[model samples]
Target: MGDENVDEIIKDFILLQDDIVIDRYSNGGANGELYFGERKLLSDRVALKFYYYNKDVSTHNEPLILKSIEHPNILKIYDAKIIHQQYAYFLTPEISGGDLKNFKDNNIVSFYDAINITQGILNGLSELHKNPNNLLHRDLKPKNILIDQETKTPYIADFGSVKFISNAENSVVASKSTQIYRPNESVVQNVYNRQSDIYQVGIIFFQLLGGKFPEAPFEWLDDRQKSKFLKISGSEFEKWQFIDSAIDNLIVKNKLLDYDSLPAYINNKVKAVIKTATNKDLNKRYFTCSEFIKDLFDLKKQNKDWRIDNQEIYANKENKKYYRISEDKKGYCLQVSKNQVNWTKDNKHDGTLESIISRIHKD
Candidate 1:
């Protein structure tokens, strides 16, 4: 739709309600538009989500789900209304800090800050998982995580792909938006349960820590290709082009570094937690979000000073200050303004620092 049409719609929406439209936010997927507005009576700023009448089940159920969920880490729904059965609108507290993706891109979040943000996300997820509604946030990515500008707290938002599994007949509903975060079991066996969300949480945890998505050397294909492969059953997967060879390559490459190759900042115990959370085997993964949070807290307690001062430079690309830690004749030294970090004794570079920063700027 054109800008004028959208503005007219917003104006009309404002007239119909007791809220004043401050400005219109970006358009969302699935025919949704976000707006910043204030309630006339209370003058409270809120984020308004507007959706034109659509047949999508989630579009109709999102407000209901948000209303049922009551947690500090979860986004709050102030009110919802359908106007003339043509538009559906809902209000939430306006978060000025933007989403996690924007925060990760703009600021150099310290390890402690990363932990706090991640913990907030986990806290929210735990609440959702434990809710009697049996909610599953099928779309759990950085973009869906909103940050509070004042407190720098994280809030899980966007229930467009939420699924309820309370009923015995509940089945998985596939979506292209969340293909990258899908667990191995969901892809291969067409099985999705609470464990699947845990796996995605693990991915988000890795991203928060490393500033990039975990990419095993074996994943030669891009996300699109992988999504296509995921649609095929495991029994027939081998028939695809060089599937066996790819799996063999992954196994061989994984043995080289394993999870132990993570940076010195991430100790063995932390690595163990991440490994278990993202384990391909559902039987081995954390059965509940609370279990994952406990292990994360244990790791946090062990490290008195979680902040790594040197790591901060890597995140601030605008400063143009890049450094590589290396050992010279005297002792270990840091080389500044370098394209890449020097390979360690094991011939492994810090992929998180070198690759993630570059990728973020490119994006």
Candidate 2:
């Protein structure tokens, strides 16, 4: 049947179900479409994704994979159904805040907000990486990350390219993965592992920190462009030399001011983290999301006297004392006063503010 006819049938079929299709959300994979919907019984808003059964095994397994995991930062699957063994539908909460790409395009994300969003994504990845079901989100890009309008929290979505690490032997190379965010090892060796996901996260972090992606010469070009360039050049070694030169330029160039022009201390730390995460060697990159989170928190704690201008102040509701933590020329210090604390403690540099707060709360 034609796609138009199939879509019409699916639309009519969905109406018969409990959901009222509000509007078309997006064109999903070649054989699928996403719709903004509302449940008739409860009037609850939802995102309905419909896929033809003949699409691919991954499309059919997407719902099951999502249903297996339950994390706030991960996309929640509300319902699923197979219509007459032809079309499969899966329902999830409608994220009006849209994807990360939209969010980044519309607003100037603060340093703290970037860290928070990246941390949330890392937390979701941690859950996916742990225990019985070791899964790799082979495709982790800004478009696949949805944000909640109210909470401003980011949620990982679109599991169509998810892979089970345990079944690596049986898995085929993901030729369709987004090359911009793909890891070097994966691109060169056709291997997608946990480290590959980490590499994508690193790219996301770089994007969040710097407005533009890291330009590695031919790496930024699409496959077709790269192919044509290589065909004209006739030497793969020339491409490697060009890529190496780009990397060297990035190393020497002072481009940190392009993003938010963050403080030198904060900017250096962020760069260091990105460098480690995006390292070409899988062994050198962050082994787990938890490790990456630790580095981010440590960076947050490392800078002394790093002024967060116009940022929200944290206060203890019970004590009514405003708390501010910052690093200075001396060391890390916590300031507590009626509204803002100016007094600096010179000898309190044991750990990060997060650790200190956790210790104090425990005590």
Candidate 3:
């Protein structure tokens, strides 16, 4: 569908509603569009999400799912309506802080912030996994977690791919989660359950700590292979195709996630928690959201004021030197310190995290 065609659908929706007025377009994805809208009756601005009916995307269950799980850490659904089965539109109070991906990319996520955010997400997941609900958030990624600009609270958003565990015996659906975030079992055996949800949460937890998405079950690939993937010369679509093929090859080999990429500043306890949560072996993974939440709390008690006050520190094991990257009005600033304390800025290495890390060994 073209942009004009989608716009016309939005126009049709506006015509049907008397009080709902879409102010402007916010963003969009493969499934639908998000707009900043207002409820005239309530005098409140809302996030209006409109999903065009498509067989490929399962968004029809989102409204009921949101209504079922009413949580402070979960996105609240105000109202919803289906217009002639062509489009499904819903309203949620606008989250000003945007999604976690943008929040992570733009600012430094401190250990404190990381723990708090992850816990908030787990709290929301607890509601879904507990009795009466017995639901699974089939998709849990950075993009699906929304941040509140004012309180810095994280709210679990997006429920289009949710599934009820109770119905497992009667219904079986193919997993549609993004490939990188999928657990090994989900990718290999088509299993989507509580553990699968935990695995995806583990990936997001790692990203929250290191600011990089882990390529689980393929993270062990040698530097040469990784370098080729990074240096691939092609259009965005072609690069993605190459990535897909690489992931497929890794799946065929039955590889597992590795923790080599995590920064040294992260304590062993934290890493152990992450490893257990994302363990390729379902038996080793946390059995429930409550277990994950308890371990996180224990870590907090053990390391109240995580020794390093600086949030941007990243270590390169090859050089045995610690580096910190900070963002300023000009660009990213890279600094190096043999010990974690004293520092010297490396003027020539100000760029993206990948670029800075790539040059860390050379220095």
The TM-score leader among the candidates is 3
Backbone clashes in each candidate structure, one number apiece? Answer: 0, 4, 0
lDDT of 1: 0.65
Question: TM-score for model 3?
Answer: 0.73
Score each candidate by Cα lDDT: 0.65, 0.67, 0.73
- The CA root-mean-square deviation of candidate 3, after full C-alpha superposition on the true structure, stands at 8.5
Where does candidate 2 stray beyond 4 Å? 1-6, 15-21, 28-31, 54-58, 167-175, 214-266, 303-363
Candidate 2 has its poorest 10 consecutive residues by lDDT at: 250-259
lDDT string, candidate 3, 1-363, tens digits: 233556676766665767867667755543678777678889887887888765556657887788877898999998887764578787889887789888877766766677788899999998888888888888899889999876779998888788787844522354766887777777667777787788778878888887345545345345776787678788888766766666755543434344666664566788889988887788889988889989988876554222123655454433356667767777677887778689898876547655665565345
lDDT winner: 3
User: Which of 2 and 3 is ahead in TM-score?
Assistant: 3
User: Which ranges of candidate 3 are over 4 A from the true structure?
Assistant: 1-5, 15-21, 53-59, 167-174, 214-242, 248-258, 304-363
CA displacement after TM-score superposition, residue 337 of candidate 2 (Å): 16
Ranking by TM-score: 3, 1, 2
After aligning candidate 2 to the native by TM-score, how far in Å is the CA of 340 from where it should be? 13
Report per-prediction Cα RMSD to one decimal: 9.3, 8.8, 8.5
Error of 2 at 341 (Å): 18
